[model samples]
Target: MNSIEVEHLTKKFGDFIAVNDISFQVKEGEIFGFLGANGAGKTTAIKMMSGLLQPTSGTAMVAGYDVITQSKLIKRNIGYMSQRFSLYNDLTVFENMQLFGTIYKIPRRELKDRIMDSLARLDMTKQANLLVNSIPLGWKQKLAFATAILHKPKIVFLDEPTSGVDPIVRREFWNLIYETASTGVTILVTTHYMDEAEYCHRISIMADGVIRLLGTPEELKKQVGVNTINDVFVEYVKH
Candidate 1:
């Protein structure tokens, strides 16, 4: 089953086209990488699918809800984590999660249990009382991810979720992503990291507001006669 279905989705700013008629589908349990250089329209497309923006002309169904008419429903069924730290710096980790859970309308009693369970999963139960700003950058990123899914949304949008972290941290973060995907939740991530892109089940490379390549990492490597996704990316964005 597909968690996201997009058809001829376009976003324009007056005469400038931000996202051209792009169409794609992300299947349940898949980690889809949306890659592009700066100003490549990846963010524009994501906002539309996430219901933060209205498309100029096209259609999108996210988590079985229409982006145009059912945006509130789509918002209810999705989680989002960004590269920028989105949690409250002054709040304790547990408090931060509690704030988001409350917004998601999770019951007060159940929310505490769920937050504790999630912290235990991350092995960060000891740090629950720590202020979010006091934690390491990597740990904060991981926490942001945990909080995003506390509601167990059907789909998650991770915008540069692994950015600015060390290689070891990135790997650990990917482990979290894999664990979530195993539970049949779809993830659509945008990143500039080529190595991280290789970890995706499939990737779409965008350039000048259009997708120039779409396939599995290995397929793209073979198609481009390259040995790694990094090289394939270099070949596309350099043009």
Candidate 2:
């Protein structure tokens, strides 16, 4: 089953197009990577699918809701985390979780259990009272991700997640992403890291606001006569 279906999706700012007519489908429980350089329209496409921005043309269904008419429902059923830290820095970890739980309107009884489960999964229970700003960059990112999915949204949109973290932290972050995807929650992530692209089940590489390539990492490499995803990316994106 497809968790996301986008067809002929486009976004225009007056006469300039940010995302041209693009189409793709992300299967349920799959890690779908949107790979591109800066200003490649990845963010625009993501915003449209996440219901943060209205599209100029075309159609998309996210978490089974139409992007145009049912955006409010779409927002309720999806989680989003960006490259920049999204949690309240002054709020303690537990408090941050509480704020989001309330925002998601999770039941009081269920919220407590969800908070404990998320903190434990990240091994962050011990630091529950610590302010978000007091944590390391990696930990903050992990906590942000944990909180984003605290309400158990059907799909999660991760925009440039793991951008500034070290290799070890990046690996740990990906582990969390894999864990989330394992539970049948669809994941749509945008990244510039080629190695990270390899972690995705499938990837769509955007160039000049258009998806130039779409396939599994190995398939892309084979098609381009390259040995690695990094080479395949360079071959397709740098041309």
Candidate 3:
């Protein structure tokens, strides 16, 4: 079964429609990109799929659990890293990991191994004791991602994860994401960066409140007859 499935999903905020009847599916282990301009409803749609917000209509399923009816199960099956990193500035890296470990109810022995593995993967084992505020933004972002998936969730949601990071760091971050996906973890990532969209196996582009296009990177390029996703996005937005 697909890791994520959305059928005519919609979310409204009073008089404003944040996400209109949009639908898409993400297969297991696939890297699916959600792309749009600012205020294009990417975040809102993700929030609904992640079960952080309820949809006004239609349905979504994540990891074999219904989003609206089985929100708790969905929460347990998914990891989320928001645009802000969401790490406590005062907390040490190890301390922050420990806290999330407890919240996720990971066993003590397993948690220790997982923490060690995560630190090693991030190459931050030596700096585990340092406060989050002392680390560079890129490292902090990586740490946040490690924390989010520490519990080995079935899917991970990254909302504009590479927004403010340097290009080198962003490329490194994408490498980590690629490595994670190799382990059968589905990734539903949202970003406004057109370059990053090309890296995904498939992408859905949102405009106003609905998805205007869904296709592979190559297919999207061919459809718009453009060399880059930026030009494709611009072409759509203009019309």
Measure candidate 2: CA RMSD: 0.8
Cα lDDT tens digits, model 3, 150-203, are 999999999999989999999999999999999999998998788898889999
Q: How do the residues 1-239 of candidate 1 rate in per-residue lDDT, one tens digit apiece? A: 99999999999999999999998999999999999998999888989998999999999999999999999999999999976989999999999999999999999999999999999999999999999989999999999999999999999999999888999999999999999999999999988888899999999999999999999999999999999899999999898
Question: lDDT of each structure?
Answer: 0.95, 0.93, 0.93
Q: After superposition, how far is residue 60 of candidate 3 from its true place, in Å?
A: 0.4
RMSD to truth, every model? 0.7, 0.8, 0.9
lDDT, ranked from best to worst: 1, 2, 3
Model 3 ranges off by over 4 Å = none
Please give the TM-score that candidate 1 achieves against the real structure.
0.99
User: What does candidate 2's lDDT look like per residue over 132-219, in tens digits?
Assistant: 9899999999998999999999999999889888999899999999999999999999887889999999999998889999999989
**lDDT of model 2 at position 190:** 88
Candidates 1 and 3 compared: the better one by TM-score is 1
